[model samples]
Structures are given as structure tokens and as C-alpha cells.
Target: MALRLDRRRLVMGGGLGLAALALPGGAALAKTLLSASGFTHGVASGEPGPDSLLLWSRYVPAGEADETRLDAEIALDPDFRQVAARGVVRTGAYRDWTVKITLDGLEPGQTYWYRFIGPDGSRSQTGRARTLPVGRAERFRIGLFSCSNLPMGWFNAYAHAAARDDVDLWLHVGDYVYEYGIGSYAADDRIAERVVLPAHDHEMVALADYRLRFACYRADPDLQALHAAAPMVCVWDDHESTNDSWEGGAQNHQPATEGDWSTRRAAAVQAYLEWMPISEEPWKSYPIGDLATLYRTESRLIGRTRQADIGAAYREGTEAALTAFRDGVWQDASATMLGSTQEAWLARELRANARTTAWQVVGMGTIMGRTVMPGDALDLLRPDLSEGAVRSFANAARAGRIGLPMWMDRWDGYPAARSRFLKAAQAADADLVMLSGDSHNAWAFSLSEDGRPAGVEFAGQAVTSNGMEKQLGVAPSVAARSFVAANPEMAWAQPSGRGYMMIDITPERVGGEWIFMETVKARTSAVAGAHRMTVEKGRRRFTA
Candidate 1:
């Protein structure tokens, strides 16, 4: 089914509402009009405030061009009838032909359109931007997305969300771009059209390589549309640098082949800052009027301890040995997703905003809810499976029987850290609503401590990455039922889906819907299904 978008119909209810209509054009349509040869990458705005936001664009000067100075315009109308703000900025080859301008003197909670002018008097494509609400707002909508792998499939989810007008702001939790080399993250026989940039076919390790990678991804029309449609808040996950990244190292990084971790990490960070329309702060929180407090946290690379190797724990041989390893070292308190410093900051933020904001939403990278392996996980396997698959399924089941977390990459591996964060939220008496994306699966969790409700989590599926069905070789419905059956805290789940989420917040409640697209293999706005969950104000729990 085609996406049902209402750009002009405003959502009015409780404390929040949906504003209809979004700027049109899917990826294919967008590509036909925008190019990378000149003002190739479309314009974007982000790091929004009540009165200001950053506008960005890339310009390639004409032959033997000496000057890099260009003019930017912000207007009330698409045709620039009402030029609200205008400024000139310079972009040299040093910064890869990209320029950013911070425009001020604008009203809060209002929509504006902007564009850039080249030295040759040519104009960039128009873009839309919105400022954060200052005081009381009727409602706010935030689009959540993650794990957009170009080689996996088309970015249909990004296209679908870009076509919706209800979304006031777009927040990409992480994995904005993959770091895998060619024929790495994707299937060996990947689709020809889905192949990634050949400029740096190998994994991104240096600053120039990372810059090229971002340039390649930014060239995408759907991604460009998402950025052009509204202001965005973003954070990078491990894949942005390398897989399972932490404070010290990463799973995908090999010092011998990749060089120093610190050097590579620095390159990734620099490239991200130069390309994205964001501020320099490692992490920050945003106030959406009195409705919600959105905390965008840096979950990977900053403070996280290295993720646990659950597979190693399972390889301990004897049943008793496996049981011992699973309980003892697996539950280490030192293992953290958020280091002590950030953890304290988060705790204080939760307490400080509890009294004012109706909802405390933490936009993070990984799944915070507990997701264990199914006890009968092996039963779903086919008889012709390889030995390695059987062994993995057996270990998964064994780990579940012993109450060990199946995936160390998520918060489940660091239960103590999660517990501390949840307890801190509970202590603050906060109405917590967690927004997470990384698992590539949709999940609704009712978080609790000591059998008492603590909060709720809305985990969005990947933009195109394969999910549980592909990972575990199970049917979508079967995976959903099994996940719910295995985890009491999980209210619902769709373990095999590729899409994003729409989170609507009001003073009275928080509403969310996981919008599943028909396919990412083909460029289409058709939707296959949607699952919705709601949490009443002050309840700290979602409706079943």
C-alpha cells in the first residue's frame, strides 16, 4: 500500500498532533533532478534551536575556479518571495567543497525553506527546515532511523519517511553509513545496482577515505530528501567507524591491517563533522516545548567498554564451565555501554527534566531491553544446515537456558549498566520513553525493576539491513511470536522487517508506529504493515 500522508491536516489531540504533507519525490525521481557534478548533493539543515539552525550544501567550482565564496538564502516561501535571512559563506577544496551557514533571527516552531547560490549565479535545490519549539507546543513528531546499508538494498524507508509531512524532525540514531569494504557486509552476489561507492572500495580507515564514503552516501537522493525535508539530529553507531566499536577498539578493526585505532577513529569523526549538518558536541539534549526532552547520546566509541564476546563464553566446553562463565564474567559491572561520566550526566538530566517535560526520551544506538535466545531455537533450523549453524543454534539455546544474553552487542550484555540507568530514571520519577535503533528489528518493551514498571522502549527496525528472519532463518511471524514468548518484558516484536519508526509525543501520551515497507530491494513507497504502541502520561509503561 502507498504511504498515507496528510501534509495540510494537522494532528490535534492530548498535547501533540501530526502535521500533514511532506516534500515529495522518491529516490529515483530525486536523482533525475539532482546531481553530484556541481551543486550535486542537495541542501540540508540541522542542529536546530528556537532561533537558529545550520544549513549545509556542497559546491564544485567551475574550471580553474579561484574563489569559493557563495551566497545562501532562507525564505518563508519556496520561490524566495520572502527572504528572511541571507548570508555568504566560503568553501575551499580543503573542506571538500562543502559549506555550512548558521542562520539566526527566526521564530521558534516555524517552518522555513533555504537554498544556496553558486559563484556562477546557479542556485542549489531548495530545502525545508524547522526550528525547535520554544514554549508550550501542541505536539511534535520525530522520525527515527538507523542501519542504512547501501549494498543491502534501496533506501525505500528513507524515501517513505521523506514523503511524510507529519515528521517535524528526523533523528538518525546511528549507522548512518556502513564502513565495510566491497563484498564485505552484503551478500557475495549482491545486486549490481546496490553496489556501493568504488572510490574507496576497501574499508574506510583514513580521513580522506571516510570523506569519500560520506560523499558517496550523501549523493543518495533518498538520504538527501530526508535531510532536505527537515532538520535532523544524529549520532554515529559502530558501523559508522567499524563494527562493535568501543572506547579502546572495535571488532572489525585489526591494528595490523587497519593501522592505529585512534588514528582511524579520528578520521571517522572528522569526516562525520564535516559532512553532517550537526554541532561539535559529542552528545546533547533537546527540549521539545513541555512535551518531551530528547537526549541524543553517543553510545559507541566514546565511553563504552568493549562488547562482550558471548561466543567465547559458550565455547567453554563443559556445561558447568559454560554456566559459570555466563553468570560470572558476563555480569561484570565494569562492562558499560555508557561510561561512568555520561551515565551520571544522563541520570542528572533525567532528574532535572522530570518535573518539567512530560516525556523523557533517550535517543540511543542499541537495544536497551532484554532479548534472550529462544530455548527451542534449534527446532526451527533445517536439517540440511551446516555444522556451524547447528553449533551456533545449540550455543544460543544453551545460553538462554542459563539466562545468558544472546547478543553482546546490545545492552543485554551489560545488564548492570542498564539496571543502573533504569533505576536512575525510576528514582527521578521520570516518565521515560526510549527511542533506539540498531537491532534491525522492531520491538516494544515494558521495562521494569524489581517487578515495578520503570519505562517503555520503542526500538525501530533497520532501514535496509536484514533482520532476525534472515539472521535466524525463521518466518517473520514465527520470529515475532518466539521473541515475545521468550521475553516477558517485551510486549510485542517484529524480528524480521526493514523500515523506520514514527514517534509522536504529546503532554498526555507518547504514540509510536513501526512502519514496515513493502520492499527495500526495489524503490517503492508501498507499505507492508505497521505496528503501533502507546504510553499514557506518567504511566512509564506502554499499552499491551
Candidate 2:
């Protein structure tokens, strides 16, 4: 059902500011100057379909009242000369004054402008959104983003992508907001003018804390511009809850100090749903004409098994025991990343979408390709490490003997799970294109199963999070060259760039362009580097 709206002209008294205060009897009683806090977070639209889109905004009442009725309108013109859809949504303190309404009955492949009006007649900034193209669409462009840590640097990637005219949809894989408190993760020297709000000074654990943290993140102008530019499809990763989170617990979350893991996880999910302009579904798939079907998967806090603890293994057992443990328990077949239900669903979708569409795109968190660090990679870094680092290097080299990957936090930890997904894609003969993030580095991998090409992956870099270069204490080019040389599956890598990925899909080919920002420490959207790669239709391999 469409939203009901009062057709009466809202009383306009003062311009812009809150003009009047209404009485209990639906009468204007007094006049008061109101701040523009009602639309402080701005408006966004998402979950686009051929005939529908969801609208969202955060409203703050002028007075002490906990609830307010706001009006929303969809129009064909910027001035709202031809109002297509009009409705009223009630927002209360329960949802932090956030209002989301799904507007349906719209034409396919059409653009629309929308805005929200507060009770006091304060209008929000106009936002533009469009529905998905129907039937044989010739082309579609998608902007991919992830790991937008506010304190680390400016959101130049968001700002850069918002200026593009070709993007039809934007996908944020995960880590939209960092849960770390002030002076954590990001160095103080690296933090420029951007500072988180006072209310979000501490790490987010409770519902209120998470809510405030999102509010702080959404307040950024660059991030807001990206939201208003195009329809967004978002998924939350570890930072939205806690770092390296699984189904039962997280790395950063301690049950004794942060309360129950379930409670904290629930709070984080709720806050993310309320803030993001997306549907309540944990995962969804979008069909772009006959060209592609985009599948958004949940890899964390859904069905993921406990990750391997190499640190614990080293501390508790001898090096020989650690090797045995890595060779045995670490490769447990029962361990899963997407669990059984989601895994089955993805397989079914791959087969179905492959038969119907030209491309099957898996939108997910973390890299899907195997990236085991070369055993000799440590040799190149020995000169850079301090005297105290010798022990750390020895431990890492010991683990490397048993063929452990660089980062257990990613798909490298779940080799069996990855194989299962790959096998399904291979069985379906799907031209799978995996779009991923969470490594904070740009990567392109030629993935295969059973010695046959199954798919290709384009993992985008972070918006502002520090990448391997920071941790390795090496130059950006050095890290990139080292990884690319070490792994045959990784065709290319940019281990230090902070930016987004631009994906263009056509019937004949799918192309990915890595747009590296000049410096995340500044506000400019200058380009530092860019690399493009393409895969031919049905080949499931990158073309030179």
C-alpha cells in the first residue's frame, strides 16, 4: 500500500528555520526559531528495482517531543512540479528518528527526485534515484567501495566516485564505518581535519554507541554526496560489529568486558540496518537487465566457523606441533565461511543466473582467491626488520613451511569453503565475477577449481584504511610488486592505494578499473594511479 499523506498545504511561516510550534489540538500555538537538525544526516535511496526504491532519512524534532510525522515526496522534476509519489512516515525515538519508506509503482529505467519535509516545514536536501533498467540493457556501471575509516583520512574515494556521471549503482561491500574509538587504528599524525563526534569517542558496543558512531560517519559531506548521488547496496563486515568477527564471537570483542557477544552483535546489526539505505535482508541479489545478476553474500556473523588461531598454536605447542596442527585441525573440512544454507543458496543462484544472464557477479566481503605468502618473501624484508623482529620472522617462517597464507582473516583461512563455492560455479559453467573488499588493497585474481578456470575476482581497495604497506613498513610499489610476483593467481595488486573500483558490464565483456586516489590524507580527489583489466564473456579468465 502507498503511504497516506495529508493534501493540505503545510503552513509556511518563517523561511528555512522552524517557524511555529503546534498545540495538542492540531493548532498552531506559538512561534519558535528551529535549527536545521531535522535533516542533519541527509536523505538516501537504495534497493532499486524495476518499479520500486527505498527512501531513508534521519529526522530530529525541533522540540522535546520524541516522535514526529514527516512528509516524503517523489517527483519527476527537481522542483517537484510533477509529484509521482507522496506519503507521510512517522519516526520516533525508538529508531533514532530514522524514517525509511519503500516507494513502489514507478516506471522502469526512470529517474526520480525525492525529499523529506519535517513537521515544522523544514525541507531536506533533494536526492536523485533511479530504477534498474528492464530487458536488454546494453551497459551498466557500478562503483565499488569498502573500509571507509573516517579517522584514517579523508573520504576522497567517495568524493571521487560521486562526481562520475556513468555510475548507475553503488555497492559498499563492508566496513562502511570503523568501530574503533579515537586514537585507535589510525595514527593521530595521519588524521587531518576530520574528527569523530564527541558522542562516538568510545568504541561502539551498545546499540546507542553504534547508532552514534553511524551518525558521526553519515555526517561527512563526502559520504553524504555519495549516498545522494546514486542508489546504494550495502553489507556490514567486522568493524560494523567488531574486528574479525565470526558467527559466535569477534577478535576485538571480549565477552567479559563488552558483555554478551550476541547482544553486541545484535546491536551492531540493528544500528547498521537503521542507518544504511538498504533492505532488512542480510543478503540480496540484483538483476541488471539480461546483462548481469549481482549476488550480495554475508560471510561474517552469519554461518562462518571459528577462525584458526595460529598465535595460540605457537604459544601453546612446539614448532613441530604447530606444523601438525596447521596440517590437521586448520584444514578441517567442517569449517565454513558462508555456512550450509547460504552456500547452497549461492550455488543455486549461480546456476540459475548463469542460465538467464550474461554475467554472474558475486558481491561479497574479503578476497575469494587464495593468497599464500611466498616462503621467500621474508628474505626481501629481512633488512627492514629490527633486531627484535627476528623472533617474529622465525615464527612466521616456521608457519610458512606448512603453506600457511599471509592473512588468516580472509578466504585463505577457509580453503575448503572456498573450494566448495568454486566447485559449484564450475559445475554451473558460470562466468562468475567476484567483487570483493576487506583486504584494504586492490587485487585481481584468476580463480580456478580442479585445474579449470571457475571465475575471476576484482577486490577493491579501501577508502581510507591503511593497507599492507603500513604494516610491512615498506613502500607501496614494493608491496604491490612482491605480492604480484609471489602469487600466480594474483595478476595485479596495489597494496597501498586507498580508493574504489569502477566496474563496467556488457554482453561481450566485464571490465574493472582501479581508481587510486592521490592522497587520502588530503581532501582532494586527485588520481595517483589506475589499472584496468577485462574478462571476455564465457571465458571466466582475464584477457590481456
Segments in model 2 whose C-alpha atoms lie over 4 Å from true places: 1-36, 185-189, 198-201, 316-319, 380-398, 472-475
lDDT of 1: 0.80
Off by over 4 Å in 1: 1-37, 64-67, 185-189, 199-201, 471-474
Residue pairs in clash, model 1: 6-20, 6-21, 7-20, 7-21, 11-18, 15-138, 16-139, 21-165, 35-40, 36-40
Q: In model 1, how large is the Cα lDDT of residue 351?
A: 95
Could you tell me how far off, in angstroms, the CA of residue 217 lies in candidate 2 after the best superposition? 0.7
Candidate 1: clashing residue pairs, number: 10
Q: What's the TM-score of each model vs. the native? A: 0.90, 0.89
The residue-by-residue lDDT of candidate 2 on 1-544, one tens digit each, is 0110111311222321111211232122111111234576778999999888899998877668878999999988899999888888998878878899988888888889999998888898888888898899899999999999877888899888988888888999999988876646435435634544322236788997788677657766678788888899887788989899999999999888889999999999888888999888877888888988988889999899888878876676477777777788778898898999999998988888889889999888888887866555555453656765655655665665566776677887887888899999998888899999999988999998888898899999999988766546556577678777767688888777889999999999999999999998867889998999999998888885
Q: Candidate 2's error at 389, in angstroms? A: 6.6
Which candidate has the top score in TM-score?
A: 1
